[model samples]
Target: MIAGEFYKWTDKKGTVHFTDNYLSIPHEYRHQIKIQKMEETSEKKMEGIAAELLIKKSVNEERKAISDGEKAFNEKCTKCHSLSGKNQDDSATQLVGLLYSDKFKESTLPVSEDSVKRIIKEGGGEDMPSFPEMTDKELNELMRYLIPYLKKK
Candidate 1:
């Protein structure tokens, strides 16, 4: 039926009726009738729900990855690279400043993801112990934690 062309009317005995034919509705009650649009189809509604679920799942996964990265950094690097700048012993470096320093940029060590992965696995120097035992996945997580600090000024 064409939208806005349908009619609803109540009879004298209080029974209600709906029809697409304008003639079926009595003249007195015709002014009271109003057409209503159809609601969305189930398929359309389900598609919207599915899209929303996918977006939520992606966001949740990102949050989990970040949390895991922070945990890995704390477990692996905090011993040799102090998170706080103060009170670092001779054996350890203050990591926060080092990440943004020109010296760090000039070093032979590469800072890109794959290069960082190699360095983490092989160790940067004699002063830094090799973490050959760390899996590629764990190294990735640690790198995620450190990459923000390594950004150029």
Candidate 2:
């Protein structure tokens, strides 16, 4: 129709009813029903839809980042590093309890995001080679994946 409208009414039991069709109102309450413009309702609906879409987008992006981070770790660091404290090689370092490790706890440097990022980008002695080629996005995603496993301070 040219203009949209809303019909609202309250029943004898104080239950409120709302509808867009005028004919849906009961015969007895038809004359007492209040008429409202659809503009406010449409705006509210649009806002709700927008918020829901935004939340879904954020969740999808987070899942993708986690997946990418796991892939990156498998490709780049899994050879010499072990997650879940299961070392394939005795020489490899266990990365599961990074903050809780004797090396990190004993060292003057705290186990922090900056320190971890630096170690990944730079080298942690001859055993660990620097990955200067790793992009910032890949590093960030990898860090996110590792954050949960890292022992909190």
Candidate 3:
């Protein structure tokens, strides 16, 4: 891909919206990006506010999902891919945290029990390993545990 300038506009709420295609932005914000280069401080302030708001939103939504994912990870994945002091860098344990991120919520990255199970039992990536012995039922249980986080976004 070639590197190029991206047009970004700050909303009234200070959210920094970005787009490569001009049609992605609303008319209200279209002028903001065009005018923003005139002042840099305001841009920084807007980005900071946007970041703060993003963090706050993420922290607020996982009250129950986080608890459930942790419980499931502790109960199941912990059996082998331990999250103990000795296995601090464990792969399975580490994956639990991102099992249901909004980043993977779409069809492009569907986070379901079956999806996780397939990866677990048929692991193939550079850092992945197969848990071929695991049954479909077990995978479903794991997905059940992670359902909350999957639904978060």
Candidate 4:
């Protein structure tokens, strides 16, 4: 049936009643009857619910991307780079701090998303090797994981 306005009230017997006619309600129940505009309330509630679900879905997707990124890092980058600065050594670079390190800051490349992605895709000089085989989606997931560790100037 098409949505329309209606009145609802609870009677003395505690039975809830609904009717489209306002005057049909008993005079005593009239004081407590609520006028509900079905179309407006339903549409608004649905919109609110849809927005909430979209936000939740986006959060979940980002979380999954971050998790995937961490996995990729462990599989491909842990040998030469460390996320916790505990693996600082002759061969390993502890990438635990901001991207503003002397190495990155001094380079010709700017500290932006595109630059960072390019650096990752095409090696960062003698020490860093290029990930020529890594897919763009994988690279994006890896970036999501590394974002928390990098602070921009």
Candidate 5:
């Protein structure tokens, strides 16, 4: 049957009937009938649902990445670099200023992201311990978490 067209008529008992065929509807009521369009195709509806699902999945993945990055940073870096600057010792530098320091901003010496990653992986001289066991995915997430603070504008 064709979509979007409707026929309306009153039966002999004066009850109203609605059908899709205009020819089956009594001749007198055809002039007063109005066409009603279908809302959307099943494919279009499914596409909309798919789009919503993709958006939800993307958001969930982003949240998971942020959470994992935070956890990795807390576990791996907090011992040497204090977030609040209250518990930092002389053996390790406070991280709050490391990103904005002249060395980091200029990407000089041991201050760039590549340098930081290498330090995280290989240990920074005698004071820092190596985290060679960290997976590539974990490192990427950790870097993403640090990028906003560490990257020069």
Candidate 6:
């Protein structure tokens, strides 16, 4: 019997791919297109779903990394640095007070903001510990916080 209202074909290799116009092919070739198109459609759908899942996972990972950085700064830098409008009761604040003294003002050392950041990164005297782990941005922020108190009269 004819395959259907629309005939199709196959090859000796057993591939069943189809075209709507298959009338010129031999009878033996008709079986090749007989199986179904739904299987291929399902495979493509699965591939699309996998790609979407991977994209979502990458975005989530980036957000998580930023969250972890913020948390770490709060736990570490916060122990010493105070936010704006806050009291200066912390050890780091007290240290900054000394830097603002007339003696510091009189010192020949450079008074620029980058210089202040270097002091924080490398430590001034034996009383201060090295902050090798702090990023350049964090060091700059810490220096900015202290600069107000250390301004020249």
RMSD of candidate 5 to the truth, in angstroms, is: 15.7
Cα-lDDT of candidate 3: 0.56
Candidate-wise lDDT, in order: 0.65, 0.75, 0.56, 0.75, 0.66, 0.55
lDDT of 2 at 24: 57
Give candidate 3 misplaced runs (Cα > 4 Å).
1-72, 75-112
Candidate 5 TM-score over all chains jointly: 0.55
- Report the Cα lDDT for candidate 6: 0.55
TM value for model 4: 0.66
What TM-score, computed on C-alpha atoms, does each candidate reach? 0.57, 0.65, 0.33, 0.66, 0.55, 0.35
Expressed as tens digits, the lDDT of each residue in 16-101 for candidate 6 is 33433455456666555553343445667545645654775677665665556456546665665544433444344443454455
Over the stretch 1-153, how does candidate 5's per-residue lDDT look in tens digits? 365544445666876555555665678777767554444436575455456547756887877887898899988787667556443334246555565665455664566677777877888758888889987788878887776655433
lDDT of each residue in 20-125, candidate 1, tens digit only: 5676568888777766333433557445545654775688677777789899778777777766546433434655545556555788866466776777788876
Model 4: residue 95 alpha-carbon error in angstroms: 1.5
Number of clashing pairs per prediction, in order: 0, 0, 0, 0, 0, 4
Candidate 4 residue lDDT tens string, 1-153: 125666668898897666655766789888997876666567776566456547756897999999999999999998877776553334336665547666667777787777878878998868889998989999999999987776633
lDDT, candidate 2, at 56? 56
What does candidate 3's lDDT look like per residue over 90-120, in tens digits? 4434443454543345447455566766777
Lowest-sum lDDT 10-residue window in model 1: 36-45
Question: Using TM-score as the measure, what is the rank order of every candidate, best first?
Answer: 4, 2, 1, 5, 6, 3
Write candidate 2's Cα lDDT for 1-153 as tens digits. Answer: 126665668899997766555665689999887776667567876465456547756887898998899999999888877676554224347777677777777788877887988889987867789999888998899988887776632
